[model samples]
Target chain A: MSNATQPTAKPDERVKEISAFRNALIRPELGGIVGTVAVFTFFLLFAFDSGMFNSQGIMNWSVVSAQFMIIAVGACLLMIAGEFDLSVGSMIGFAGMMIAIFSVTYGWPVWAAIIVTFVLCTAIGALNGWIVIRTGLPSFIVTLAFLFILRGFTIFLPQVIERKTIIGGILDVAEGDWLAPVFGGTIFKGLFVWLGEAGLIATFERGTKQGQPVVDGIPMLIIWAIALIIFGHVLLTKTKFGNWIFAAGGDAEAARNSGVPVNRVKILMFMFTAFCATVFAVCQVMEFGSAGADRGLLKEFEAIIAVVIGGALLTGGYGSVLGAALGALIFGVVQQGLFFAGVESSLFRVFLGVILLGAVILNTYIRRIITGER
Target chain B: MTGNSKFHHGDPKGAVQPIIEMKNIEKHFGRVIALAGVSFDVKPGECHCLLGDNGAGKSTFIKTMSGVHQPTAGEIFFEGKPMHFDDPRDAISAGIATVHQHLAMIPLMSVSRNFFMGNEPTRKVAGISFFDKKRADEVTMEEMRKMGINLRGPDQAVGTLSGGERQTVAIARAVHFGAKILILDEPTSALGVRQTSNVLATIDRVRKQGIGVVFISHNVRHALAVGDRFTVLNRGQTLGTAARGEISPEELQDLMAGGQELAQLEGSLGGTV
Candidate 1:
């Protein structure tokens, strides 16, 4: 009874001070950015031996990096929602095959084939979501089964339509002019190309018979990748669906109790991942003019590796779409850098494995420190 | 205590029904009967205390009331009208909010974010969505001020807050969202004496706002201090109900221990050895 009415220190003040301190060090995507930079620097150092330090080599690597970045961004969002789609690689091959079978074999218009293939691909994605929701089974198992199913379908699909192992219509989109400017176009011409060649004068152009600029123009894939990255960043940071994705992965039980439709969110995540795979398939088909069963083989592992390297937690709940795109860029740079550096192409797998493992370990330790678990 | 005199003068016609009423509520988890024929009432603007030992159906009762589980047999009336709740959302929509002992909050999320997690403010243009962080932060800070919670900012992660502060935040959030019937499950069980006082003060504040409060706690002294009426439950059954004036601290303790039943239990324990 001595001082029952005395004022005390406010609780919110203390909480705010501590939270401000925590925010200064725990950036959501810092780990991924750091890992990407580290890998890029490593490759850049080795790349000098094979003239990869030159502007032309840099432009070529950048072009190759763009495709992986686009697909990885979408994969990152799906992973953040607490599910995976191993069937993405197969979906890519299937979409490419569908476009080829329709446009080339059936003699349909390219635009119509593209639209139809996309619709069919989206349907396949919805089907995958339906199966997972109905069975209440692990998505890893379900999507793995789907991967095999799609692979078999892709191989047998051509035989059914054309009475042969090979299909002809795929070559049109892969090497066609109508889509070249959109999907397979180059971007580094005009001012940038002239500026890159200005300093080198005619000697640099003379060394190469083709008289191409010292640096090639930016690739269309790079433009697409940048656009996708911006869109994904906006979607993840500013949307209600983005918040739901974080909540679903953070704690499914708590989210469900809070009235979030966890099942629907997970299903939508899977469908989005599949849609990304289909988009990538269309791009690949345009670039290669062939829709073979092996078009996207093992690409799923690359996408997952990119996400993991980008600092996405294996257990979900924390990561960034931007980080995943950066990770894919790192992968592409390393792949092209090694080729230019005269490293045996067969040894690329070992090098990638080491880099991926290192990134995972670093990501785990950083996460632990951020959470104050160690 | 003069219950007959108070009954005659205080209640008048005794026509005012409870804001919430539960009768003959039975709940079972497989073979175990968690609650059997339990009944209780909460009057408006009064702090009703539910006292019990551990495993005396407190959790079961709270769950049933919050719509986590449908009671096996029961009649529940809200404002003299029968109602059915299929889920926690249903209870929430009905102005019945529950603050559990553990508190349901995402630790990694900030205070304001957690406060407005499900009911977030959004801005939409051309069917695309955008979260209004500025509005959310502003509204959350205003709510905190109204609840007398002095915080440095709304950006602090809720995990960093002390246990009593977290409970206060949860209670404040529920109250801000228009909860009329607030159920606090063991709110002070995990707190120290000072924190316990803070929670009791919060309960009093809630009652003063004309909200019916069901405060569940095992601490007899604390319950007696804040409670206007006390109901005792033993083995999932109602032992008795007593007005705060009708029971002394020691008498309430005895009733909570099952009085005669406890004496028989002591005798058996002493004789067996």
Candidate 2:
């Protein structure tokens, strides 16, 4: 083996470069990147005439990916910190209901309702963290319990207080409010409209307006998702706290011995997950102009799958926010792509399962190489 | 190995006070007694071996000293000043660092990241302050080199390192953080002969830096090789503390019950081999 690769007789005196470029190419996110390309191409070939490649179609999937990523970013960070928050999906439903009932039924301003919802969600997240830490229970079980508790409350509260399963009037309550634009609705809507009007984008051949295209303004969810991903990426990779999160997840005892406040880091991670869920709830309420008790169902699973596909270990401590973002994108494209191709929507779960299995296996193989594990 | 002469290079000679002095320390784990009234002291710039067999309270004593558990009753003095540590961080802040057998370095993290860990360096990039990767890499390499560990890449994950190298990283990290007293828990138990020598050499280098070293081990030969002084423990009590030359390796083993156990095993075998 030693004789196979011979070195020069004399070492180079000047600075010599190693194959650093190759090393950079095989980063942990490479699996996600490769998987995304393969999936995108496969769909592109079969679904070409289905408008899946069109700008509107792309935007539709991107919006879906954004919604998934907002929570996935949080879930990814929490996973890196060695925990899970299954209640995030339930928190979404609960937060939406809180915002709706407070504003529409109690006559509270939309802004006040949003603030209260966030505070309540934050508290619920802390309780999840606290119970897990204090009682020394598995976060999976604790958050699973929280999942049911919050979901039950979301459904039960509307029946008891609002006397309704679904509450409307979210946009009506948000109307004429200063804070509405911040938490709800679109941005640069007029700009996109202007672009469409200027023939920069495809316009309708025949419609009520004659020229306006079906593609509307950029969704606020997409903007918030990108911003949150940046924040999560920095917080996971740039800060001292980020280092602590990795250490804590990799080995909690080792991290504690190293003087990392693991409990605090995990608790803060749980809070972030809840906060992301709340953001999703706000956007959904704004987008639909209505709130339902069953909103955000199975979102936690989507976020976890995205995080896992992004190359995070289900056991924790190894992942990237960018990878999770890519994972979300993959899920969104496949889910929407199949629909555009006229495939049955129920097959989406099967597709999700197959993709999750393949991504995880690929991720595991990549991780073995990165960790140099035999 | 037997005299003050072994400590010629920067070793605290003749008149230095003990870095840490534990007096009549006692610890209990609920219904079980892990350690019973034991006294230990480590002076600056010398390897003090804590010799014991399994369940001999060596681990418990180290934990108590390192602040993993509060002593049920005892007093600990740091540099002759009585101190109390509620957590490991307190002890660490007081310049005492413990390298447990399963060293504190996270295997998945890079050498530099593991080295900095909770005490990372930070700098601003595009007006956003973050952990300073450049500084961490530089210092980790420098400290490791000082310990005779020349790592080719600071970003290499620590899990890829051998046991002895991981121990070296832990020691280097402790030294980097300005630890005055180093507590190594069975540092060489799982290492091969070559790796054990590497660890011993690191201990020697650390001692030359004028830091107190507590070397916990069951191997008498290994301890006798570098230890300036040795303290023997048996069943949670101090058998005796001996300075180098005060006792031989064979004698230390006897005190740790190694001789008796060997004799019992020989009797059990009844001269079959």
Candidate 3:
């Protein structure tokens, strides 16, 4: 027999380096980060009018971006798991309506209303999962039906409670003291008022007065968004359930043969998407102070766009919550930046279309290149 | 050249007890008979080659052995004990691992991740779950080393590897998981000459560990090169069995092509010569 040919150390090391480089390039979110940064830089340069493109304007953009970032994180997770949920918008509306109707109309305590809303929203999510799993129907159709059904319910349910177009008391929770410190705490303000009165004010308040800015306080929605993003990131990347999610989305048959419960993973993914919608609904109700059927209209599209732009493949198996967060930031910046750049707000829709198409093309090309299919 | 001499020392022997035995195994898909009374055995540490033309019950037999299909009749015995398997999971647990021709791996997952997928190493802290990625990567590297596979990295996607490397990974996975019976379904069918040799070498390595291997192939040369025992199946029946020394590569090829039947058909095609 001939001598066994061992691979040389130098060539082997080169191969290892190349493989690592290829892996880094092929990561799903890499495209999203590039797209986000590119879009952000484009808008930043275009809005060169110093009057509207200052620090305050940026801060205002961030506040708007935070909301979409929260929703996009959840949407990214759902998309990565290879499913879509159209019912998120409707779930948000229903959840907000529930909180408002219970707290304001029915005179229930704030905490009680919050608990009831979550439970009801979670049940709705479970129902969506059950329906999809049992019938093996496309989530798009299931969630689209859910969207209209929940919209109708939100509209009709309020009339039954108080015959009003708007449901109340939900805003108090958004501004409630119990959740305010965690979710809506004021920044740079009365808490440091004593320091401001003393000579320590300059060291503490370099950017604002009273060693505190009497900002609208941090909105509970922003806090919830950050928390959910972290939680979702951990769930999708580090658990056996997360592995099952990838396997189910990547190749369900292989996963099943490998002993993964494919059905259960799909059910869980759908439920998680619904849970996110419910949480967003609660935050919206709190932030706006009332629930209306129109509260979450078209937000589902926004969430989907954020997820897709964040580096999620429409065909699934690859995505990140962080990428979605960045995508949402990109969207928020563009939406607000256009107005600041003196572009007609009506033309924002056209800009979004271009960005969405461009993102999809870029993602496809990147995938091909990484897989050496190009 | 000599009769029983060839059958004695380093020679052909048909009298050895089978390590894995299938008796009167029958299977049907609705009204179609996929397999009928097919029986075979793989001796321990021996490379048993199963050969058949297309639609000759080869796939059905493999699926039955790998637990993809439960036989409608008869029994499968591992080491002389009758075994019943309900699913591929049961077969795997029973130490029967199948390396399919089309590849049964999720392409996008990393090599190490796919290697330890269903059996992930995990660490739990404060009610939160975390995969032990470091340990998984190390174990995967070790397993690959045993099969002489020098992967670029544990993080490389399985889809990016060469066909032979992928097969090596699958074989290594089987060996690592204590698979005493390795069932390879056309593992070298989709490879170039060099890649085919790599796979054959890997098979040799597997056999050296005293594992019973079932090598299913269409190429008689390839089969004869690695197989110790040969079994030919035609239209859901075992045509014949021969030890390595009992038959030459040409004879095996003829048998695989249905020796007498092919000649009879050729004779019928001739115009009364």
Stretches of candidate 1 off by over 4 Å are A1-8, A11-23, A43-55, A159-168, A171-182, A185-218, B1-17, B26-36, B53-55, B70-74, B124-127, B142-153, B188-201, B218-222, B248-261, B264-273
lDDT-better candidate, 1 vs 2 = 2
- Compared with the true structure, what per-residue lDDT tens digits does model 3 show for residues A1-374? 11233422123433435555755777667766787778667776877764445535765677677878777876777677677888888888888887778788887777777777777777777788789878988889988999999999999998887898687655554444464244334354453454435544233346554244323234556667778888877777887777777777777777666677877887777777777777777666655677886788888899999888877787777777787887888888888888788889989899789878987887887666544454
* TM-score of each model, paired residue for residue: 0.84, 0.91, 0.86
Q: Put down candidate 2 lDDT per residue, B62-176, tens digits, no spaces.
A: 9889887899998999888999999877888899999998788887788999999989999987887799888899998878777666565897778767788899899988998
lDDT of 2 at A177: 88
Name the 10 consecutive residues with the lowest summed lDDT in model 3 chain A: A1-10
**Candidate 2: segments with Cα more than 4 A from true spot:** A1-26, A204-213, B1-14, B28-36, B72-74, B125-128, B258-273
DockQ of every candidate: 0.31, 0.37, 0.35
Error of 3 at B119 (Å): 1.7
> Candidate 1 lDDT, tens digit per residue, B1-273?
223232221232346678888888999889999999888888888888899988888888978888888999999888889988898888989988898876766655667877876777799878876877788888888876765567667766665566777788888888888988999999999998877777777888788899999999888888987998888778898776777797777556656676776557757887331
Per residue, candidate 2 scores C-alpha lDDT tens digits across A1-374 of 11221212123234243477755744667767987999889888899898877768878888888888899999999998899989888999999998988999999998898888899898889889989899989999999998999899999999999788899988877899887777666777777678788987777778586677557677778889999999999888889889999998999989988889999998999998999999999999988888898999999999999999898888787889999999988888888988998999999999899988987887777667556687
**Candidate 3 ranges beyond 4 A from true positions:** A1-24, A39-59, A105-107, A172-212, B1-19, B125-127, B254-261, B264-273
TM-score of chain B of each: 0.88, 0.89, 0.87
Best candidate according to lDDT: 2
Best by DockQ: 2
